[model samples]
Target chain A: MPIIINLDVMMAKRKMSLNELSEKVGITLSNLSILKTGKAKAIRFSTLESICEVLDCQPGDLLEFHNKE
Target chain B: MKTQTILNIMFFLAWFVFIALLIKAGTILTTFSISWFNDMAAEKMYFDLDLSMYKSYSPIHYSLIVINKVILITAQAYVALLMTELLKGFNLKNPFNHLTVRLMEKICFSILVIWVMSIIHNAHLKALEKSVGLSAEYLDGSYLLWSALVYVLAQVFKRGVEIQTENQYTI
Candidate 1:
């Protein structure tokens, strides 16, 4: 998909470990890992909201779109 | 008993019965007994469809009968096996997996094979009617419709598996 998850980059910039983000976002580590690894098909608005609130970042920082060749 | 156990027993019994019939067919081909068919016809059961119409039987005619019976029994066995596989899938934690969809596809393929075999058998019966005065006319349409329905069901199951994967991956 053109839409890519950049969750790992945001987490790195914020110096947030996966376990810490999972605890703060109230989601399982596996689910958070799925998103961070760009394996997630979609992000729920509530989950995105929780992640943004925890990391203090915009949705754009966690998601990116690059045109596929 | 749970439904899965019941289904398992039923499928096992069905396979056993079909295998028995296959053995009986083999014996019939080897013995070539008219009285066996006559006894079945006398019972007026499923075998009485067009048995009365055959006044005499040649070796070739008996061979045709044997072949047609084998085809029908093979189709039934195929269906029974597919049903067992489907029941096994239903017994799983995730019944709507890719393997389930593949089993459904195999079912559809088996139905199609049965339909084609039925058509060929019907044509052979017509030929026998012209050559040997055997008045059997078996033209079943349900198998074609059934195959189409199963094909659609396989597609639905395929979509279900895809959605399940998407759901798992969604965060």
Candidate 2:
């Protein structure tokens, strides 16, 4: 849980909606929402690659690390 | 035949047998039957509980016999019903769900109850040897190990359900 997903920020910077990103990344809206909400247990390299390509951003730009304390 | 069909057939048969046993236990059928100590084998291999001793039909004696049969039959019926539920899990889309795991644990618990009842019934028979004129000599407690195995299997199923949930949530 310390690894937070900042997919919403990247999507906003790219000026793309969840539906648009999902359509371009070839993933379902629900799955994209899961990634955006930090509910996904894991992200496949292929899926990450597709999302990065669609959003024009690196994996690090979409993910962040934080300490609970 | 499909596995679900087979399981359903088995469940119905078990339920039917349980109902038959229940009827038999609820009635006075055993009182009139001739129970003998042996089948007249050369070595006198077996003994049966003779209920014909109460020719006058003492209410207390008749009730005792009925209660004993009812207890044993009820335990058997409960075990059969548990097995039916266990079989039902296999027909589900996801057999390793929480409900299935709970059902498996209930089956293990029911088997333990049957095992404990058998031991208690044996003990009662031993205690009543002087009055009843018959007793069971040996106690076959093999089901305890089986119950332990079933309990372990239920735990494994619980773990499986956890893994399945995690996999589903992994997206």
Best by DockQ: 1
What 10-residue stretch in candidate 2 chain B is worst by lDDT?
Answer: B37-46
lDDT of 2 at B136: 39
Per residue, candidate 1 scores C-alpha lDDT tens digits across B45-80 of: 244334434424654664566567677766767777
Tens digit per residue, CA lDDT, model 2, B102-153: 8778878877886887677566556656676643344466878988999999
lDDT of each: 0.75, 0.70
Pull out the clashing pairs in model 2: none
Off-target runs (Cα >4 Å) in candidate 1 are B1-57, B91-93, B137-139
- Runs in model 2 deviating more than 4 A are B28-49, B52-69, B130-133, B137-140
Every model's TM-score: 0.81, 0.74
Give the distance in Å from residue B42's predicted Cα in candidate 2 to where it truly belongs: 27
Going through the candidates in order, the fraction of native interface contacts each one reproduces equals 0.95, 0.55
Score residue A13 of candidate 2 by CA lDDT. 93
- The C-alpha local distance difference test score for the whole of candidate 2 amounts to 0.70
